[model samples]
Target chain A: MGNVSVSELRYIVGPSSYDSVGSKAMKVKKFLQDYFPSQDYLRRLGVCVFEAEANLAIHTTSGGDLLIVIYNNRVKVVAQDTGPGIPDIDKALTPGFTTAPEMARQLGFGGGVGLNNIKRFADSFWLESLKRGTTLVFEVWNDDSTQFDY
Target chain B: MKINEICKTVDAEILQSKGRLHIDIHTAFAADLMSDTLFIIMRDEDPLLLITGVTNLSVVRTASILDIPAVMIVRGKNVPPETIQLAEQNEIVLLRSKHIMFVVCGLLYKAGIQGVSWEM
Candidate 1:
């Protein structure tokens, strides 16, 4: 099927953005579950949303914004953070390679799987980083096009 | 095993049941690392329980997002109020155990709870 935009939503992510700091990720997950496609798409979308949100919260200094665009057969997620870009994109994308602080590690994150998980779950992915910030955009198809978990 | 049964087997305290103690769970995935937990694709027929040493909001978040029915915190780690509150809100059963990860796994295994087999 041809790509057709269906709906779009955006949210700010930071310490003071939500009543509970990390609860925004769950909200995104719930929103997609109710409005987007289901089954494999929901599974993959859930992981991508959580990871992207976690990366924005744990890695960045000033937090970021998450934009979710739902298409006819896919969902595109673009997450952009403010300041202190990744020094090594390659290393950051590596599984088990992490620079997350101990506090984040204790929270079961910063295990270096956030970016890797996003890359694996997304049908197509793109990333850009500068000293000012980092931005990641990826898409997961609604149809059971392929199994990315394997 | 049912959520309540698993709790009794591991000597775990039922921190937050949300009236979900009767739910049957057949598979389990234990990890202190949430990133790894996210990698697992749980099957729908066999409800999964998350066994973790971490007592943080992310554990609850991971379980909630993945549709995991219950979470068992090992080593008797003190779960914060917010984590327990979140779990309750999500309707996810939260459990706490004094046993370490290895021991808890063994106990659950003996109780007929199987480790999750990730579909390839």
Candidate 2:
């Protein structure tokens, strides 16, 4: 197949945004599911991408932007936000670790698993969080080289 | 084995996914933290029962990503219309019950939902 470029798909949602925060994540999942239409495959990708968006919102900034570009049977997700930054990258990567705000925890988020989840789902992953801000980049090829559960 | 029987055991309301309410629940997952589910979750055919105190659009979003069709908001909390709406859109069934998560699990286990099995 040719490249599936979605540079056109991008949006930003923030703290003051609204009652529901994970809308962007939902949008990405829906788009991909429609584009690929694999019941088993899509949902797992949904969980991974949604968690990434949720972290940027609840941890980094009250708001943020997510860029989803589908290319060459590979999907790339870039999440960025304005926040204090991750003090300890190593600790944050820990599965049980969470720098998430109270609201996130109350809502069952911020347990520091977003990156981990994203890594597990995508074919490849990278992370950067500093005093300035944090950015996470993930890429997954459509070749089913990636598995969801095990 | 049967989803209908599982629902009855948990006293969970079949809010959105009626058609799937009774699907076989070969596996069950319980966690208030989203992180654990993302990494450890491993199984395809096993229908999942997501038990959490959270009832938000994100929760539904998580369920959708995980391809989990059934979610039960425990502690008898009211799942906002938006959350229910999202869940419905994702084709996920949401149930609300007054019982705490721990108690709910006990009942489901007794009712024969073995959580995730090693069989597959």
Candidate 3:
């Protein structure tokens, strides 16, 4: 048999761009479902990716890129945006805290749950924020035995 | 409850169903914030019905990703044709009610729909 190959997917998230985030998320979800072995893992990863993309669309000022890599044992996602970095990472991670504009709230977004949800679903989470941009990296393991319900 | 029953209870109009109104939904979540909705559905195993006054393409996309059976847009909001098209394409049952968010939630609760437990 031939050696198996990994799959990689990437997307560009534009600043203040609202139309394509959902579509990009859908594509990522479908890709995960096709390759991942566990349904629970797929669901969690899907939610995390969706929330991350939505945040990029809402908060970023200079657009960003989303990268997804599917390996034999895990899936990884990195979202990098060129916007003003989050001022208070701790406060921003709070479940109900939000600095989203009134329009975002009115449109059923900016509830301050996006990053929190991403943390809840990701097996490992990392963040880097500066004055110029923010980058988030999260991973989900394919092993079902190690999964925890939260 | 069946989606059809929820629709009847709220006097909702079917914007786009793709013949999925018969799908059973065990829990109901009311939120205009897509992030909150995403959080609840991610943790819950039961079928869900999302009720929101925020009618936007993202709403349909959220339901599709979470595999939510139906979405009821309250306040009789006029959803754009593109949103309706997206819902149809995703096979999500889209509904619109004349009642506001509070009234719609009350009506659904009265009609035997239960709120999602936030235990997680």
Candidate 4:
């Protein structure tokens, strides 16, 4: 059961948000590219979603899950995890300050750039983590006719 | 220098990989911190060579998503067999250079491999 669109993508990752999991995001990108070959915004959307997936896997508990939703007008990525919440939003969102697990650092996901990079490419981003877990949402507006010159 | 040429010149033992070198790179920097490399290196440049001291699955993970095709693990250390296997799985060329990261990067630069203007 997924979103129904002329062309839509929804990816779900449960705690396997490692660097390897980026391929899941790529799968959606490939599907979208089949429809919009020259759409740069869609490409950008893929990059952000990949980062969010990495974030969820690196920071959240193993059973945590991340979801990427691609609709007709916008691509939204939601990463939710039943793991320890981020204690400091400001610092965690910084460009190079990461609290990622050591193993994640070795793989290159926690250069502390995931969120910032996601924010840089995404049109709107919201990250909320409470005692239960963290929920991150990233959206990118896509119309697929021209370049996004902003 | 071309990535293929760099591979030939150094005494780097291929750990895991096989793919045509699609792009030629001039200079490179080696570091364990993905943060430093992300800011310092040019992401768009293909066949960009990265030498890292980090020995973890994340190393391959970062390099793969970033599209870095060449990763040289330096120092006397070696990547775990699984990580090496993983690097191969991802189509990223993993090599073990007997030279330390600093020396390898310096030699490549001295031999005219190249370097992007790194800004702070």
Which of the two, 1 or 3, has more TM-score?
A: 3
lDDT of 1 by residue, B14-60 (tens): 99979467888888998988878988876667788999987877788
The prediction achieving the highest DockQ against the true structure is 3
Q: How good is chain A of candidate 3, measured by TM-score?
A: 0.91
- Estimate, for each residue in A103-127, the C-alpha lDDT of model 3 and write its tens digit: 6676777888889888877889999
Q: For all candidates in order, state the fraction of native interface contacts they contain.
A: 0.64, 0.72, 0.74, 0.30
Clashing pairs in 3: A108-B32
TM-scores of the models, in the order given? 0.88, 0.86, 0.92, 0.74
Tens digits of per-residue lDDT, candidate 2, A1-150, equal: 455555547877575343455567677777776567666566556666677767766765456778888766667888887766888888877776776667667666666777766776677788888777878888866675554445
- How well does model 2 score by local distance difference test? 0.71
Candidate lDDT values, in order:
0.81, 0.71, 0.82, 0.67
Error at B49, model 3, angstroms: 0.7
Predicted model with the maximum lDDT: 3
Candidate 1 ranges with C-alpha deviation above 4 Å = A1-5, A15-22, A37-39, A147-150, B118-120
**Top-TM-score structure, candidate number:** 3
Candidate 2 at B63: error in angstroms?
A: 1.4
TM-score, model 1 to reference: 0.88
